[model samples]
Target: MSRLKLAICVLDDIQPLRRVGSMANDALVLLFMIAIVLVVMAVTLIGGFYLVKYLVERTFNS
Candidate 1:
C-alpha cells in the first residue's frame, strides 16, 4: 500500500539517527575496553622482556 510505504519512509529517517547514536556509544565502549587490554598486555610484555634479559645475562656471566 502507498500508506504503508509512506509510513516506512518516515520511520526510516528517525531510525538512522537512533542507530548512529547507539553505534557511537558501542564503539566508544569497545575502544575503552581495547585500551585497557592493550595497557595490560604492554605491562606484561615489558616485565617479561626484562625478566628474560636478566636471566640470560646471569646465565652467560656465571
Candidate 2:
C-alpha cells in the first residue's frame, strides 16, 4: 500500500512537468513569429526609405 501511494505521488509530480514541457514549445514558436515579423517590417521600411530618396532626388535635381 505504501509503495502504491508513493507511485501515485511521483506520478502527480511528473504530470505538471510533462504539461510544462509541452507548453514550453510555444515560447520558441512565439519567438520565431516575432523575429519574422520584425524582419518583414525592417525590409518594408528600408524599401520605403529608398523609394522616398529616389523621388526626392528626381524631383529636385531633374
Candidate 3:
C-alpha cells in the first residue's frame, strides 16, 4: 500500500509537465494555421487590386 501511494504521488508530479507540453504543441499548431490564413488573404487582396486596376485602365484607354 505504501509503494502504491508513492507511485501515485510521482505520477501526480509529472502531470503538469505533460499538460505544459500538450499546450505548447497546441499553440504551435494555432500559430501555423494563422500564418497560412494570413498569407492566403494577402494574395487575394493583391490579386483583386491588380485586376481592378487593369479593368479601369482598359476602360479609360479605349
**Per-residue accuracy of model 2 over 34-57 as CA lDDT, tens digit each:** 999999999999999999999999
Q: Compute each candidate's TM-score over C-alphas.
A: 0.59, 0.69, 0.79
Model 2 compared with the native: what TM-score?
A: 0.69
| Poorest lDDT segment (10 consecutive residues) of candidate 2 | 19-28
TM-score of 3: 0.79
Error of 3 at 12 (Å): 0.6
Clashing pairs in model 3, backbone N/Cα/C closer than 3 A: none
Report the CA-based lDDT of candidate 1 relative to the real structure: 0.99
Worst 10 residues of 1 by lDDT: 7-16
Using lDDT as the measure, the top candidate is 3
Cα lDDT of candidate 3 equals 1.00
lDDT of 3 at 1: 100
lDDT leaderboard ranking: 3, 1, 2
Residue 6, candidate 1: Cα error in Å is 16
